[model samples]
Target: MKKILIFSASIGNGHNQTAKAMQESLGEQGYSSMIIDTLEYVSPTFHKILLESYMNLLRLSPKMWGKIYHNSERSRLIEINVLMLLANKLKKLINSVKPDAFIATHPFASCMLSVLKGRNNWSIPIYTIITDFTIHPSWINHHIDYYFIAHEQLKYLIDIYREDPEKFKAMGIPIMKKFREPLDKEKLRETFGLKNNQKCILLSGGGLGLGSMEKVLDGLNNIDLPLKTFVLTGKNQKLFRKVSKHTYRHEVVPLPFIDNVHEYLHVADLIVTKSGGLTTAEVLSKQVPMIVHNPLPGQEERNSHFLLNNGCAVHATVSEQLIYFIRELLYNPIKVDHMKQMAKRIAKPNAAEDIARFIMEDMASKAVSKVPLGGE
Candidate 1:
């Protein structure tokens, strides 16, 4: 079996989640894959607090978060130090696993691979999968063999930076296998103790629950719609408890880091979420229309653009607008149908399988090229 090493960081949950999905896909395709958190390999304590603080800042002060994100994108000087550390570690990792190829789902890993390619040559292939629709300069490097971008727009964006148009492939975004599977809407709704006719709006603030979850709930509670709301307060116990206390006539279900997002998506009429690439892709796979609420700046702003352009989702920057949009969407079934159809059209259900097939084919070609002419 071919061996693949998937690298991801815990800065955001999406990167690690994508790595897990890809690992599972490769396993089902008869490939041995290992998923490793790059930050844990470096400094667990620093990464933990840094990741937590990043999420908290995004929730409390998105403008500050945006500024920091933008600054990080431009700081090549600081990146050189990061690149050196990553290069040394990667040299050790590759020497140990001897993977046939390396797949990176995080920007830091991509940058490190670029730096390593210049310093030391690895005969094995290196692939970078952009989890977001937007492209950052850090995600580009001349040494990458293949790039799996979330959209065609990202391909163009990266080509502008890397100056190689042929290296990138717009494979759509990758999502968990469950999102690609079919779920019975009525059955799922009944299982969740929700009425068959009542529209369920699923609200998510990402894995760390970084958005204004309580404020959004309050706004939705004041709305004059007969809709049930499901809030996923991932890793945010305070927000979950506070939202659950609101005794609204319509049922409000508050959860903490649920494993069955596909089930919720199956029964949800609309999804109100921060426009993280992975969540957007999952929602697309489920054929659920979206209302992006308070997207973190930089890549998320670009992610919002992709959904808006595709007619798969709408944007609401404030709580009041979010509630109004929800009310309108729940009332106007035709518009909601249109959005859902657009989302379905864009969903690449076989993305993970497609990527695995490509990698395996490349591996086969390489192995065949190395055969001796007179070998038995």
Candidate 2:
């Protein structure tokens, strides 16, 4: 069996989630794989500082983060220097692992691996998985063998920077296998104590619980509709406690950090979430209409734009607008159905399986080419 190396960073859940999905898929295909957090491997101090700074920036001032992201696009020299600094550590890992192929789910990993592959003259294929809907300039690297993107529009965006259209594949974002499996809505609702007749709205703050859960729940309670809300505060104990104390006109179920999020998504008629890449992909896979709330100003904002442009989601910057959008969707089920249909059109539930199969086929072809014509 061949071994695969997947590198990801822990800045956010999306990157690690994507790596795990690919690992599971490859495992099912009879391959062994390892997933490593790049920053954790390179420098623990740098990783801690970067992760804390990122969370603080997003919470305190998203616009500032946006400015940093935009400025970094033009800071190619600085990015190159950073990659050079980390090249030795990455090269050591590659040598120690001696894997057949490498995959990177984070931009930092991708950039560093690309540089190391070139410097060491390694022949192993290196694939980059773009975790977001939009392609950032920092992700562009000439040494990458393949670029897996979330959508076709992103391919076009990357083409402006690198003119190799064939190198790009719009495979959608790889999500957990559970999301791809068929879910029985009635059974899920019953298991979760949700009423079948009432509309269910799932309010998620992503893995870190970054959004305003209490305020959103309060606004949702004001909507004069017969609805049941399932709130996932996601490791934010304070937010969970605050939401649990409040009583609303409708039924409110508050949960903190669940492993079975897909089951909750299965029972929901609609979702209210901040537009993180993985969350948006999961919602789209479930074909549930979404109300995006307070997306952080960088990739989340771009993810929001993609969803809104595609008509599968509505953006709400404030509590009143969120309530209004919920009422609108609930009162008009036709519109909700339309959004669901749009989601179904764009959803790629089998992306991880597809990617795994593609890599296996490519490897087989290369192996066959190396064989002699007459078995000499």
The ten-residue window of minimal lDDT in model 1 covers: 367-376
Could you give candidate 1's per-residue lDDT for residues 185-230 as a string of tens digits?
Answer: 7787788888756778888854334345656666676666677888
Instruction: Rate residue 74 of model 1 by lDDT.
Output: 71
Please give, for residues 23-135, the per-residue lDDT of candidate 2 as tens digits. 99999999899999998899888889889988888877889998888887777524577776875677666667678888899888888888776776667788888888898
Model 2 global lDDT (CA atoms, 0 to 1): 0.82
Best by lDDT: 2
The C-alpha stretches of model 1 lying farther than 4 A from their native spots are: 71-77, 205-215, 221-225, 368-376
* Pairs that clash in candidate 2: none
List residue ranges in candidate 2 displaced over 4 A: 206-212, 368-376
